[model samples]
Target: MSASMDIRTKSLSKPVNVAQYLFTRLYQIGIRSVHGLPGDYNLVALDYLPECNLKWVGSVNELNASYAADGYARVKGISALITTFGVGELSAINGIAGAYSEMVPVVHIVGCPSTISQRNGMLLHHTLGNGDFNVFADMSASVSCAVAKLNDPAEVAAQIDHTLRECYIKSRPVYIMLPSDVVEDQVEGARLDTEIDLSIVENEPEREDYVVDLILKTLHSSKKAVVLADACAIRHRAVPELTAFLDKTNLPVFVTPMGKSAVDETKENYGGVYAGDASHPDVKALVEGADVVLAVGGLKSDFNTAGFSYKTSQLNTIDLHSDHCVVRYSEYPGVKMGGVLRKVTERLDMSKLSVQKIAHVGPQAVAEKLEGADQIIDQKWFWPRVSDFLKENDIVVTETGTANFGIWDTKFPKGVTGLNQVLWGSIGWAVGACQGAALGAKDAGSDRRTILFEGDGSFQLTAQEVSTMMRHDLNIILFVLCNDGYTIERFIHGEEAEYNDVVEWKYKELVTVFGGSEQRTKKYRVNNKGELDALLNDQDFNDRKGMRFVEVVMDRMDAPNSLRLTAEASAKNNARRE
Candidate 1:
């Protein structure tokens, strides 16, 4: 026999069910739970999750399940969601799109019809009336980095490994379609013994060194330099390396809105959250005024940059991205960010760099204090107060509309992880995300508090997921900002339009309606500052386990200052003729 044939023969081992192989692969990659809703096509596949030692988190709907999976992936590095073909997969497409936009890795597994049905061109119930089996996979191809339809047992294991590797290396969602007949097919079990290779391509040594030298030369030449960290830093898991670089240089570091909590805010050199015009005055000046700005893992989306209000010039910036790096107008491709950052830090000569003498005002010091015994819970009062309420290692999930924008001003303690879909701007994302995030936290053995700040209008979109959270008995604190209508829309155009108004449900009663027992659940409705303060100050409420819901009442027109500014900018951008 040839050497290659001998190796192949030796590598082949005992055959195992395809479903077992798939779930075992997911388990090997640290996915403790699979999130999805059961459907006829996928029900049989779901049975193997337990045998593989993976928990099944059944969501109320496919959309919520996808959102939860996205959240779980953000915390756990990667997560999986199983949905039926066509209808179920299409419903969850939006959430998957968000994952793609934000660089979150999620494996979207669609349980397809039997291979016989597809080959014979039989009309499947979930599919379009026509005999097309490839429509949903085509749609998923737009958002996902990899797409694989597993039918042949001989190739299923290799396909699964390839798809998952793409998902990890790209840090984006991947699609897999498993036909019912193929679920139990026999595949080599030894494939699981070989770890999936998820390693990224190494940086070109010469190109990386040239770019690092340019950055160092620029930094030494400039009198003022600043470090700006963004969401991609967190998505790529470059925080530890980025933090070490920041500590080494002691450069004034500021986080973008979507990148909040990327850096240790407690560090002395930490400036503040910078959101272009929405930034605190000092923060805006420090970043915009710098001669050389080093932006690491930067994602300059509209909402993140406050509708493109940033004043920094590209000529003076060094942008370090996941796959490449750009210095001023020059671009260096195939240079990995993590390696470049580590090399730069190791080679940086701190003595040559000038010390910047800028006044660094912490979030608490810059936050506006409540004025004159105002009873209403306004943005100015609420955000700062919540800053004090935040504990270490809490996972804070913010909804798109108000909570997403408002969270920019709130200070996070050390070890805190902030989850927000700023680029997608999907309104109902956080409720489902909170459920998945809580489960991910539990699986990781991190006893961190899972807190969600959701808007009334946004929460109504995916409120059923709260029931899923209750069903699992996951401990979470949900703060429903009960402003009568869509305050964000009002800030953009109509201040009091009927179209923006959402149906008012007794928010506090939702816990009971969602099947949470009163004995295990704690619910509160606070209409004034005094009432809200009492609940926040209560030790029992603060330290209690299980679900706790708080409905905070605010005026319909009330909004955070940052949202107000961004909304106005958005309106102006929409109206521009040129």
Candidate 2:
């Protein structure tokens, strides 16, 4: 026998059940829990969760479960979600699509019928009344980077490892379909000892040296240089490297909306968020007026770039991506961003860099007291007050709509992290995401508080997740903005349309309705600015134990200035031309 074949044969060890093999591999990684819903098809596989030393987080629905998993993955580096075929998997597809768009590493496992049933074309309960079992798998391929359907035991281990490796390497979602009978099929357990290759592609030595030298030369020669960091830095786990580069070169740094919290906001060189026309005047001047811009992991989506209003020329910008580096018009493939940054930082002569002293504007100061006796909670007063309430080591999650756009105005403190769905713009994502983020923080041994700023309309969509938080005893302080209806939708197209209105629910009664303990779960309703101010000042409320829910009542027409501007731009874009 050949040497390669002999080595492969010798690696096989004693046989173990397929479920054990799969869950053990997941456990070997950093995943301590699995977020999912139970169905008849996946019930047996669910049984293996506890056996493999993994906690099973039963979410209220598949979509919420997937969202929670996405949130967990963002903090824990990787997470998994298990759902049944057809209906269950399809329901979770939207969340999976969001994960893919945001570059979150999530493993989506679906339980399927037995291979015999699929071969014989037996009618399935979750199917579309058709015998075609491949339909859902095909649909999943659109959103996932890799797909694996385990039909045979001999190939199941290899398939699982391959799909998982792809999920980790690409930092995107991957789909794995496990037939009901195949869950118990025996597979060689020795393969578990062979670590899956999660390494990124290495750059060509000569090409990497040339690109780094060119970037250094351009930066050294530039009179005005700036650094723009975006969401990809966080997605690709390059925060440490980016931080090192920033520490070495004290260039002015500005982050995109999607890249908030990627850098330490307290740093003196950190300017602020840059969103083209929507950016602060100082930030706009530095980013738009720079002679040479080094953009690291920058994503220029329409919303992020303020409808493509960025005026910087590509010829003056050097874009560093996860797998490639673009120096002006020249592209160098396989040049990893983290490595290139490290090299550039090591080789660059700091004495020759830009010495222009740009004054850094700190967060806007909040008004100490409102002027009127009958003070109402409005966007102008609410955001700044909330910004003062935020402290270090807090994970802030904002729901899409007003909260998402409004949060951009709030300056995050040092060690604080911000989470939002900008590209997907999915409503009700933060509620479910809070549950997972809180749990992930606990699992990672961090005492960081998970604070969710949710919308009333968005909260109503996935309100059932509050019970899950109560069940897990997670420490999450939820602030629900009760604006009476869909405020963002009203700004987008329908100002006073009846379709935009949502049924008002008693927000304070949610804990009781969700079967939470009265002593452990605290609920409060704030109607005016004075009431909210008292709550913010109360140390007892801020230092409370267990889950605390607060509903802040506001005018239906009120919204942040940023959202109003973006909505106007969107409306103009949607208008029909003559």
Candidate 3:
């Protein structure tokens, strides 16, 4: 080995294309798959990506791919999706909007026509006959920070780096447009060292001291105070911090539906998921009767608040939201939720507050209810048995509609939880999320099994994803909640007689239909609790011999009670408002 001619020197001597280098940088920043439907303009990126160790996921439509990427990013930290100039990009707006609404970090990479062609007024494939790129650029402003580019090879590295950092810091989506001419050009400039920049800019919640001081003062005055935690709290990963705050204060805790996983459900003092009837009578009484109501990371939607019951003039309400914003309804002023909670938690009197006492009772009450339901819970029955088999570490994702309602009462062992209550209420989210969760678990090098409780209606929407899962042979468990109808919509307001019903398919046969080998799928049908019990007790079901699909037959007549009530209340409320 020559002393002067080292590995670094030799590696530096070799030249690489700028586009190729930029794609590599994306891989370094955790862009797994370039999700999109192939198009003429974007074909360059599709060609260049495989060399960078990226796989192009072929979606039936650009929108589905974007949504898949969004779900993947939401669970797996980060992901990117690509599409063609105008048509592909336009098609993906719905998924982008959903990501924007939920504050998910997804990068939208769009390929555009060359600058000369764009300026020459040439008709583009997906364009509305106008060469005006302003329309394309303007569409992204509401949901993302979008930048369209001319062929500047030098700015590739800088723009990529800037866009990622901006999106990460803001916890929002960002868009970057690549012109076809630019992507094919080779850079003649000196190469910069390719390293992963994972640093995130932390914005401390504004007005800290005032928020905490007000909360402490309010706590001292109120005899019965409650903390209403919502999805924002989970977004900030403030569960443990909020849990610590709850314990120190010994205040009652009630989570909105979106915040169901906010605290360990197995913990005592946790009023199991509250909103209308899901709010236990005791939890409801405390919430409705409280003098000072601290709503943390709350959603102001009618669904979360039970038709804005808390929109009161008399009660002193402190609202801390996920957006790092705060508001109050009080004779006295209050502070932002994050600032106050952070400050109060930092320096607090912990000597007197014994909140662990509530921990014992909180989970106990939930467990009691679960057990009571267990009397009617038959192992031969798919939902109850599957619910029972779920351990503390296993993660579960449920679809919207009937399956969502069915699993409302399913118990997660103290720490076991998953994502299902994303605000957009998008169906087919659970199946995609299950894939992401399984990937996350495998990446963590843990044996924590990832499972999905999918509704029959929603399962059909993303059925193609099964091919992706089977192709990868992911350690995932899929339990299809087979009710033979769109029971959720039927319960909500749809006509069960015609449109709500679906033609029954042998769901297990889908594995083979989707190209999974016989070894890749194990099929089971459970009509009653006995069949469910056998499957639940069988250890073979957990083995990764293949993807497991357990079809649990549910009575359409006995639809989920919570879902039925939710729809009814929402309808009645809308009627009243009208």
Tens digits of per-residue lDDT for model 2, 513-545: 998897788999988888888898899778876
Tens-digit lDDT track for model 1 on 1-578?
A: 44663564456677788899999999988899999888899989999999999999888999999999999998888999999988899999999999999999999999999989999989769978788999899999999999999987768889999999999989999999999988987778977878897776778888888988998899888888999999989998788889889888888999998898899877778888898999888899889999999999999888899999999999999999998899999888888789889888999898899858555564673335445444789887788788888898999999998888788767788889999999998889999999999999989987678999999999999999988888877779999999997899998988878899999999888888888998778899998887887788899988988899999999888898899999999999888896
Model 2 pairs whose backbones collide = none
Candidate 2 TM-score to native: 0.96
After aligning candidate 2 to the native by TM-score, how far in Å is the CA of 135 from where it should be?
Answer: 0.4
Q: Local distance difference test, per candidate? A: 0.89, 0.87, 0.65
Clashing pairs in 1: none
> Which model is ahead, 1 or 3, in terms of lDDT?
1
On residues 1-578, what C-alpha lDDT tens digit does candidate 3 reach at each position? 33442443345444456557667766777665666778888787678887888766665567667776775675666667788877888888877877777777778888888767887988867787877865776888788954535356545657777777666645568888878777755543244464645553333445555556666666666665667788777665567668878766766777776676677666556665566554445556666666767777777565555445443323467776544434354322333344457677776655533332233212222222233332333222334445567877777777776555545456567667556644666777666656656654554465667788887877877777776667667677888877767775675566557887877888878888888777767778776555666677788886565488788777665665556666677677756743
For candidate 2, what is the lDDT?
Answer: 0.87
User: What does the lDDT read for residue 300 in candidate 3?
Assistant: 58
Model 1 residue 118 distance off true place after TM-score fit, in angstroms: 0.5
Instruction: Give the candidates in order of TM-score, highest first.
Output: 1, 2, 3
Give per-candidate clash totals: 0, 0, 18
Where does model 2 exceed 4 Å of error? 1-12, 365-370, 576-578
Question: At residue 315, what lDDT does model 3 achieve?
Answer: 45
Give all TM-scores, in the order shown.
0.96, 0.96, 0.84
